[model samples]
Target: MVVESSPTMVTRSAGSCEWTLVAEDAPVLFPDENLAPKLLLERFSHDELKSGSHRVVFKLQTGNGCYYFKHYKISDWKSRLQNWVRSSRARIEWDHTWKLIELGFDTCLPVAIGEKRKGPVVRDSYLITREIPDSVQLDQFVEKVLPALPERTRRQLRFELARQLGIVTAQLHLKGVQHRDYHAGNVLVSWDETSLKLKLWLIDLHQVSFGSKLKTKQCLRNLALLNSYFSNRGNASDRRRFFRSYWQTFQTKKNGRPRGFQEYKSTLLTIEEFCDQKMWKEFARADQKWERGNRRLVILEGESEQNACRGVSELDRDFLKAVSQNPQNTFGLPLLNKSVSVTKRVTLKGEQGILSGYLTVCDKHSKPKFSARTAWDIGHAFIRRRLSTPRPLLFVEAKEQQWLVTEAIPNSMPLTDYAQSSQAHHLNFQSRRLLTRQLAAQLAWRDRCGFQDNHPTLFNILIQPDSDTFFFLGLGYLEQLNTPVSEKKIIRTLAAWTSGSLPLSGITRTDRLRFLKRYLLEKEGDWKRYWNRIDSKVHSVHSN
Candidate 1:
């Protein structure tokens, strides 16, 4: 997917340094005459690299076997790499992590540091690190071996992997390292189909943080993300097994929260005495259900103290237990006793950098009366463009906190680099028209969906896999709904793209959903209408 730039994002890096746009889709060719560290590998070597994600990993095969060399981008947003000798907490976290790295942790350890670009000790610091060999990222492993693994191995691996991840993450929190992006991809594992080994390797370490006291809330949210990943792969029973270890390992640990909630009394946040006041939101006359947006749920043990679902009653448990015992269904998810789906105790991700599976729409638990229903409706329409343009409908379902989870699109490289960009760069004749048509299709969609009604200031388009595609995201701000004049601004943007054809302004959520219900579901505004579509999309995706 080739994403278009926002007027703001055209020349930027997440680390907040200026980026040099490639005039052509060729590899970067850093000069041979340049210094050894900067010119360690040819600029062309970067064609294999995805921009602004992993540390610069250069595979230079010297006469002595194969080795992967890494250098941190000097321009990272944190801008702390300029001084390695002057230790900040991030560096301390890095240093402390190295000190505490136990054996069997097959992570990329820092081999050395390239302290300067050409000058000494002032800027352009790089960490030279090794690669995790004979191992694959969990996502890659799933793509490659998941289908091939036997049912038993997959089942067992799910629970065991969750247990391992819980233990690892809990241990990290205990050590007071709050890894901002502690999702599945950051944690690497090596499995032989007999026994699996787990290793927690921090990736994209620019956002990683260190503090004397860990924020239990933040850590739990991070852990919830882990739960989402494993749950998607395994089943409910597997997730429960994972939580058993998590509660056992981390719950009783001392000094986990540095300044108690009492310390934050002055802040907007307040520790609540009542459970419902702190936890679940009552909406539509009830709390919400786990949506298809986040495909899986994480069961955090010892979470009873957190004012979430403690455990279901013995009768509910026995019924669920019997369902798991049934040979037809492996995971012991609560059954729909009636026609309606049962409300599930699930957790989702929120932070922007990492993939928070089916992001939960955020709100203030302290609000007098909260309803994410409007947020969900707005988000679903908005996130649609993202899922459509970058790829086809990869929509995540809506859940607690108004989360929308979708299955990942398969086999995509960043559109700016690699073969996709190569195919797109310097297009001759026929290709240009085709791409124009595709963009036209997207514009038609936005036009059909009516971008003008959106709150422009709150507008965000989250592009995926580094492409020109920008899917409109973030719709919590509702005041942007148009009057007669502002609606024209959006219409003009759509009109210009489509050569003056007027797309429906999509005046209301009801209207947008009417289109969605008809186009996707072949009906209007019903949950089953959508679920049937998803079941069809992932028909082959059954539990082992």
Candidate 2:
């Protein structure tokens, strides 16, 4: 395959997931890695086919932006994955997803099929499809907007997004497609402030199930994951709002009366009603399990008597400890993915094309909590904590790197996906704040270290709700700079961050950070105001 351009602007949504685009083609798609994926490259490049069992994305660029050809391999029976043996069942699964995409019901459509010259569409089939540009995953929206908005505003945004999930999933289910794994990672949201409504787009349909006979209960159960994911984050308020909005969105007038989400609204309603008391009981139960086993509630506070894990060094052990401490409160039993060893010492979840997984914390100390394998899971928690308050970043010394035991972000999200949602409207405000303190922090860190921030990820910036708080979970990355982020740089950039005052000099790693830093700054200030008001309110809630 002759290469013309390499893919530049290589990024993931602000959400916690990463993608493996036919990145081999990235170099040929862009002369420099400065711009976001260009649609020009996606349209022009003709990639040479590579033989192997891999989940890959071939990004093509056009005039304004880029799109991608997501390639997923159909699990082959005789292939290395065959040892686990689902036989023809998995192949049937790929076909099912493809069939639905072709149905125009909307999904990541398949661009190519994986098959041997002399074989049937075997289990190990490869399906390719064009990437949806300028769209973001749900979590990214929260990351960008939460830190900048007031808690009230953040809750509103979450409810609206959750409402979207309810209505959209209900639509998908009504249409007969069950996203077996309807977790946050699998959903994408789109929006433009100029546009009236926020939109939801679904992706990663390989796990979807649809046949002549649809499983309503199982499908509805899958849809219930939105409730589970949100509830665990201590967003009971969001659960109620989501439930109400979901019910309203799906309510239909039948025989001259409105029916509340009949297809799955009942289940959604039941789950929503029990969301509080039931969740408390479960967390309490998980706590009891942890307490009996001697553990603690690290991320979330719960009444469950379970003991969390204890006596852990901030390494791989911390992850297990956190899991033991929290046990499994929401989302039921955690999923185990096929592991892949990256180096002799580490493996990157190694689950073929699976993007989302169970996030288990370790039994490490209270501060600088950690996991032996990776800190990706903490990234989400960091955003959650930061959204609610100014949580200190507890850094743990590991083998060679330091992992941060972060607070759960209030209405947090990933930058990668945030770029694609209606949440961006609120980010306009947060971006102003991001410019000042937060972005300044990076520049200050750089000045202190006397080095430059290499490959600053705009994807790293996070925002809180009511659009007030801000944080960068990639705290350790800045330490590598020749200098540490300085107060001067941060202060100077404050205006630029919020106003988009700087010329669109083009988004660089450092500049992008500065751009997002502006949003973080504004968010931080708002949060300060909120705390002051809350603190001044009658001494305390009890006093009032």
Candidate 3:
């Protein structure tokens, strides 16, 4: 493939910024009289499509068509020095766009690029490209569009997408081009519904490097980065098809035949390991964000120098303070439950109409900070794991008292109440079995993740009106184990669920057996051994 030169290249100055316009025909780019690179740069601040810490992307409309405008801001001195010595990121992306075009890969069409410099350092840069019509991000396509298609059509589309992605990636590596930020979001997909024909384009080329052969480790790292999104959204067979396509496409006559079965398996495992590490690091980063106040959360000072952490967009400070001071008397709301802690139903009028929540005030031990922080951290951990739990709204910690507020899950009831309610009798056998299996599967997943609740009882679990969905409550007793849950702990959990002290209603012996079967689906131990041990423990508990 030969690179084509633009017929016209022009440079213009707007304030301190110098804009470079490259086009096959400059007159066709800005058909409107008022549209220019200077005006477009001015409009970027107000017409944002997406904004990040260092980048702002917006869409510009001209008589010709719509184009994407991306502005990159240099924050650190290191980047400024690098840009001063070398090419700016916008220039790199502009150059890479032509390189990709020459390599016969579909990519965004570059329109114009600009950079602003101070002394010898580049402070800001911009890149503009013509928008790809009827295109969506690969992740959005898989999440939103695929599910809407028929089963057969959806399967076919998925296969084609996986195959094309593999081919494109292989071609890039074969051309000695490596994309550092290779992920689903950077790939754009467009398809015809009638013929099911798909076209893919690579975007965000600022992180790309050209003319460097990819090593084995680099290949695996790139594949793992792409696989991170699909690991959650795609199934095993989908991933297998992808790897098979990649292996077939990546092979060359000089490199011999395609990989062997052992090689493929080993590659898959390595990629999975890399993906897991990436995901864990992301989770840890999110935890750090919560600890040091992010956009969603804020840390504030409470009465008497106490500490209060609240959701920025969810609850107000006044409401949080009122609830923390005297939850039982605040707002004259009805008391929901009382034992060791006081629970009050709270309602507040907000921008989104009525916001309902539950405020629980508990007496703290000597280490109030540790206790309060533990509950807050555990609640966030459950949310991070995508478990169903009432969202934590606020946490206030004082010397002797701790207040926690949680958003109320609509149409939810405690599992204990639901089990004894008339709704339980109305559920058919299949629905009841599904509910049992769901509960068991949740417990199994939690145990597999090394999380254990000290008292795993039905009372602490909330069942939605749908019955199949369950939400965990009372996260204060939750503990994250360093090792896998032991057989003894498993038996204890089972005993807690079926003990005579709780006396759960409507659950039969068959339901318990079914739950055990589903829970042991991925376990290595003998099912009979676990069943027998759980049975023994339950029997002993009931007898006592």
Give the candidate number with the greatest lDDT: 3
User: All predictions: root-mean-square deviation over Cα?
Assistant: 23.8, 18.2, 6.2
Please provide, for model 2 over 10-82, each residue's C-alpha lDDT reduced to its tens digit, 9 standing for 90 to 100.
3322122222234443444333542232333343654543434565455555443444444445444455455
- Candidate 2 stretches with Cα past 4 Å from truth are 1-54, 62-65, 71-94, 97-104, 117-124, 145-160, 211-220, 232-241, 248-269, 273-544
- Candidate achieving the largest TM-score: 3
Considering TM-score, where higher is better, how would the candidates rank from best to worst? 3, 2, 1
For model 1, the superposed segments whose C-alpha errors exceed 4 Å read 1-35, 42-47, 52-55, 62-65, 73-97, 100-106, 117-121, 196-200, 211-215, 224-234, 251-544
lDDT tens digits, residues 235-314, model 1? Answer: 33555565556555655676454343223333113322222232222121121233322322322223223212211121
Model 1 lowest lDDT segment of ten = 1-10
lDDT of all the models against the reference?
Answer: 0.39, 0.42, 0.71
Better of 1 and 3 by lDDT: 3
- Ordered from best to worst lDDT, the candidate numbers read 3, 2, 1
* TM-scores for every predicted model: 0.40, 0.42, 0.70
> Relative to the unseen true structure, what is the C-alpha lDDT of residue 400 in candidate 1, on a scale of 0 to 100?
26
